[model samples]
Target chain A: MKHQRKPCSLEHARFLRARKKNLAIVWALRIGLLVLLLGIWELVTAVGWSDPFLTSSPSRIAKTIAGLYSDGSLFYHIGVTLAETLIGFAIAVAAGCLIALALWWSETLRKVLEPYIVVLNALPKIALGPLIIIWFGTGSKAIVFMTVLVGIIVAILHMLNAFIATDKNKILLLRSMGASKLQILLKLVIPSSLASFISMLKIAVGMAWIGSIMGEYIVSRAGLGYLIVYGGQVFKLDLVMSATCILCVLAAGMYFLVVLLEKVLVKNPDS
Target chain B: MKKEMLRFSSVTYIYHTVRGETEATRGLSFTVEEGEFVAVIGPSGCGKSTLLSLAAGLLKPSEGEVTRSGSCGYMLQRDELFPWRTIEKNLYLPLEVSKQNSPELRRRAKDLAVKYGLGEFLQSYPPQLSGGMRQRAALIRTLATDPDLLLLDEPFSALDYQTRLNVTADVAEIIRSEGKTALLITHDISEAISLADRVLVLSGRPARVSYTHELDFGDLKNPLKRRESAGFSGWFEILWKELNQ
Candidate 1:
């Protein structure tokens, strides 16, 4: 049996090896491109080809980040922004799902509010910054509210479409068994939308960051967004670059965490 | 005489949409007795699905009554298994929904799966199973509650010809052995003739029973045998003409 398997098994092994090699090559190229872009920026700045004052070399950004680290204020700003963003994301997701469920529960309510929802979604959120400041004041409360405001609409729209798009046959099957509307929602609707839910989370993560930073841009005292604003006002280009870099890393980290959640929560990710 | 399991008395259903109200079924009357397998055949879009929905009580009749003796288990065209759930969990869904979930019922459900050759696949997700296997799991899930009536909505229509025949045989044997009353809606004349004890042909849209035939394949209770019997094609020809006319 072992001898008979040798020929085809070797071919299978070769195919697997080629797949692994292709994946490695793809990842290597991704990293290599990032490193190459940074190297060129640094080389051009160091050689006086571009004004380092305006562009801010990678080395200068690194130095500014180290300074923030030594001063022990690095984590504080990160914590403030991260906490606000996470809290806003959670509230928006929860409240949005509830609102979507209510809308799905009543055709009358959905029809009545459909135009208003579309209008709210279309309106530029930043235009309401002054009103938000007036309502919540210039505190973390305002920033968190802004984050929720940005994320919740997206969550509601995404989840509502998913809820409405649930398989009609599955709903019929459940209904035939005497399952209540609530039961259908719990057993079929919610469970079937895990993929959409994860995708919504991915979008909400971006919206949460946008809302927080946008709020900070309006009236923030301390955050990466605050640092970016203050650094710009003071003409400290290195600080601005460092804060932007930190925001990128934090956003990527949060996105990866959502992806990780998709892996754990959705048993059949492909489906 | 077997007790009456389901009765549809002058049932009429109209679907209201933004465009207009369309009458789907009109003055449709039928009765399904306990322990009998009844099949409904009609042209496409002839309100066959509307009839099942009415029977399942998912929709109320527009102008008449749909009365059933007990609860129903519904199987659809596609398997409609929740891909996120294991076969075992999917089978238990009806029990959970009906508030009849218990250790004994779950065990019984599991035993049914094992009996029907899904023992090894119980831990597997629906996506992991073959199409035929998924449909079988769906039938088992329907039977989990031991419903008084089983409403099958073109349950074999999704499978390819080969798998459809095998699964049809399996489903017929299972239903017969369980002695469950079944109402199957299909457009396939051969399928209607092979499986049902009594076959009801429906008119085109605004459907009502146009003709009803009692199959006579004496002692050929198995679907595959019923198909091989001499009377199978004769009944099929009759249903075909009735359906076309």
Candidate 2:
């Protein structure tokens, strides 16, 4: 006699519904916190308890953003910054994965080249802004170079660690079954290192933004960073705060994009 | 003598560190017969894993000759299935490695999965399956290459007790049905008594064979039923006493 398994319970359905409700509650709380902070800032300025000139009231920042939007400067600056960040981040990811692969393939090369990488990573990449500007001459190229410099070493280190940390027994098992080295690398090592690589990309997104902004601050005619510098030079605290807010929003947006990519890659990693 | 599926003649292995050397297996010797299910039971740290490693050619014997008639398949303590791969793709791993990626071979691999109760979960990843199903999938992957011998290095040690019994029965059925020889290294005496035709007991580190018991549990073919046989506890006690000695 063949035994048939019982159907799943409605209790499981109820549990899943409750979990979705809890998730909605948490997201609502997060938005509420942001609103509360903004309201407090507006109230403080209206009561004359805080100087709107130095701190730049939320309403003034919003109006400044609206004015820039009406005149099209806001979109232009955003476009410039976004182009620099994406190009630099793409180059960094490619170069970083290639370097990690090279290091993993050769122990002697890794040992010989490791100290140089350490030295390069230790040097403050912000200091390279002047050199990059001199070489690439104050355009997207310099900003991209700076972003790659800031982000590549961290990506290489993380990916190499992930490759080396794969299960040794599985590798041995494959080898014992007469698998070639390339087969082991492709079938076992790379797939296992994917979660780590996605995490490194998230970190690189933030570092790339930092590098781009720092480059702009040192030597650009236009960008969010340039707007901040221009506002400071002309003593318009409102413009400076508005640019800072834009940068924050852009960075948060990129971080969330990477988080979405990670969700797709690992497909429910740790929930 | 079934052409001596594997022969290890006077093999000795030593673990060397900066401080010194510690011997794990001192001039141990054994042979596995073709299509035979052999279980190796020993005390803790008695180099059971070392023996499997040597047989798999992962480690060369320090002092003796180790020869195998055909290719080997090794299953580890953990399932070691890649989380990113679907069950069907995982089953094709060995075929992929051996450059046997033919459509017929892939179809046969799928048939094996279907026959082993993984038909519905062919597209599922390792994380989506239960522990026993994962183990079954792993075994199917191991058998996909049709290797001459299987080296099981405590494959059930990671499973809970109930899952262990169920998986053990499934594995025994699979090996017998597929007509493959297997060498299982286990610390559990009853496990050895129930699943294996012959149980080889070894001493503590620097291990050597202390006793070899041939078991017969009547007409019973199922592992659980074999465990219920009258002679089950008797063989277990004998193995326990031999391990203690």
Candidate 3:
């Protein structure tokens, strides 16, 4: 039987209007809350309720950003940090996929290397900072290496779980049709694990940021991390706060990019 | 020669795990002749699924020989339609995996989708379709490989009781129309009676063939029509007794 939906156009329009109104309120509240917090901070500092030196005022941060913008160093720092993060995130995803595939392809190799991977994952990656600097030298290479080091393990773990957890029934279905190992992997294993791959990318993006920042804390000539370190050392509280705020915006931007990519790549039911 | 499509000569299957071995089926012997529709009914957890696994050559018989002619297609209980793929793409999977995804074959698969009442849902993913539609897509997927023998393992169990009846009838009609030999494993005695040209009642695990019934309701092809036949309840009653015993 053909489905017959009641065409209550008036009710439908009213429902849509209510939904839109509620959504607009939610967004308005979100922005309003942020503005209120910033306004309070500015008020407190301007009215001498708190020491501006200890707690940097929003106006001071804005003035510091304006200063950096005129100096041409702001874009340079943002560029360096973004490039490092993107490169590190890319390398880690590619290498981690290859490693996960290797582990999946050979049970013996997986068994032999599984323990070492676990140990590496458990060990604090920041401890390896000094050694990484020495091996790659005190440059962007060291920071990139650190970023990759932080991100690759989690990527491998997420993907390996997904690969191993491929539906055994689907594999059997393929095998019954005379499909070979490569056929099954290409047709079933990888395609079915796309969600896991995207999840790993999301997680690894955060790791990449942490690694780059941590590396700069150890040693760096330029980048957002360096700006923060330099600002801290010079007792420029406004610069420190400004750099941190920029980092937050950039990280959130990259995360949204990944979310957009998920929209494009994953055919998720809800998405 | 009746052109044997599949023959299981005293097959025995033993499951090995960390907790040791469990014999799922033992001395299980049967033959599916060409163009036959056979249903196997047994107690729950009676290694009915194991029988299909062995027929599909996914499991080795520990003690007996299994000879199957041509390719085998397996239809699962949950439909196992890839959630990411559209109905058309889902049907194309077997062909793609088999490396026979020619334009001609793709067209044929699309045609099958249209013919099977999935025409409107060609671009819709499995999740968008109802449970019964998903199962139909899965059956079409299995049939895409043009397998000589189809092994159906409780393919209708996941549906609601009402949908189950309709889908069982639909699927049985499709299999018959395709002229492929089918070995269906179901616990539903009425389902077995309605769909099968022959019914094999199985013993409890280490399951073996307990008894066999040859059914003849001349021109009683459709599952609903077969169920409505005067002889249908007679077969259900006999199989029920055999299964209980």
Candidate 4:
């Protein structure tokens, strides 16, 4: 009788066990780096190596967060800032998609508007903050307008390139199948540009936050940006640091939301 | 005996560039019979794609008439399935474009997907599919509109050698089973011999038909099986010599 070979289940199990160990090691290394940085910052402040008042340690920022939470000011300011960022982002997306569609539809209009778009995109959006406040009177309207101004141009540029770069052969294929021009745009062009559009939306999320913050910095009654400016005026470094941290968390949350939407819509996790 | 589905009479195409006009196809005349599979083979840059383009009404002939009886579905070399759309949505693209998006048609498209092996992957995006599956999905998308004539422009040239053979067999069976007329433009001699009922070989640029051969491989249906037939090598050798000449 000839000897038979087995399936080598032990080797397979060993590979799996090693993979788990490697993943755990990577996670531990990441957590260790974060802890070490926090520990060093705390140690430096406690030992009088750096002034906690000026550079506000992580513990001071954490205490400030708790204090603000107890007083309910943190939630209120966060709500206001979030509203501004979201409204601005929504307007930018709508306007940007529309402008991109218009440019994709007509070469003549694209040619006519190309120079103006380039010039406006090159201009510093921050410089327009004062003019926007003057025009919209330092209210939520000014913040929203500034956000749209900052985010829409970049979104339009990205989406337009996506739309224009759509597969020409595919377009011709659709056209030969008796598809109308509007149908091509809705079916082929829109579907093809969706991934790029999602990426642009994620980018616009950050720009929207930045725009909203700049607006709040110039003129706002209540917001995280206003809190930062107010804290700086009163020489409260902890408050300023806490407000910055909150902004970071909020922006990250929004960005992750867009990424999740992309995952659901595009259905390709790798992309 | 079949009725003529497409007639290309003295069709001439010229590539008008900044340099000047260079003829791509000169006075090419051919007629595709109804329910026939005709493969156009030629050397590289010999206007095979131009022929399909003219047939599909994508490119207007500079001289003479290129007329077809009914609607045309053109498939490119690469499977251009939209990465964002599900396989099911991609299949419904033609119907959606034609404003034929009835619930019944949508269900039929789904049924077709299921009838094909893609039922399990209907909700999957293009990137999730293997190259062969994507091509099948693309073929389904092309066939969704129920076009009278299908123009395949080197639709399998992108696949690897092994995958190409399997895909060619699958596609040939699918097209034959659907009872649709097809015009395949390819440079692969074996591919042309295996899938087509008739093959027309073209010469270099300003392309014209050099020879037309009627392929008969007895009862061999699958392309790979057909390749093992006695007549397969003979046809391939003839085509290879003609292509080189």
Candidate 1: misplaced stretches above 4 Å?
A1-8, A269-271
The lDDT values for all models are 0.92, 0.88, 0.90, 0.89
Each model's TM-score? 0.95, 0.90, 0.95, 0.86
Question: Which scores higher on TM-score, 3 or 4?
Answer: 3
How do all the candidates rank in terms of TM-score, highest first? 1, 3, 2, 4
Summarize candidate 4's per-residue lDDT along A96-202 as a digit string, tens digits: 99999999999999999999999999999888776887799978889988889999999999999999998998888788677888888987889878889888988
Per-residue error (Å), model 2, residue A115: 3.8
List, residue by residue over A147-205, the lDDT tens digit for candidate 2: 88888998899898999898998898788778888888899889889889889998899
CAPRI band of model 2? medium
Sort all candidates by lDDT, best to worst. 1, 3, 4, 2
- What is candidate 1's local distance difference test score? 0.92
What DockQ values do the models have?
0.68, 0.55, 0.68, 0.53
Q: Name the weakest run of 10 consecutive residues (lDDT summed) in model 1 chain B.
A: B217-226
For each prediction in turn, the share of the native Cα contacts (below 8 Å between chains A and B) that it retains comes to 0.81, 0.74, 0.74, 0.65
Better of 2 and 3 by DockQ: 3
For B22-59, candidate 4 gives per-residue lDDT tens digits of: 89999899899998899999999998888998998878
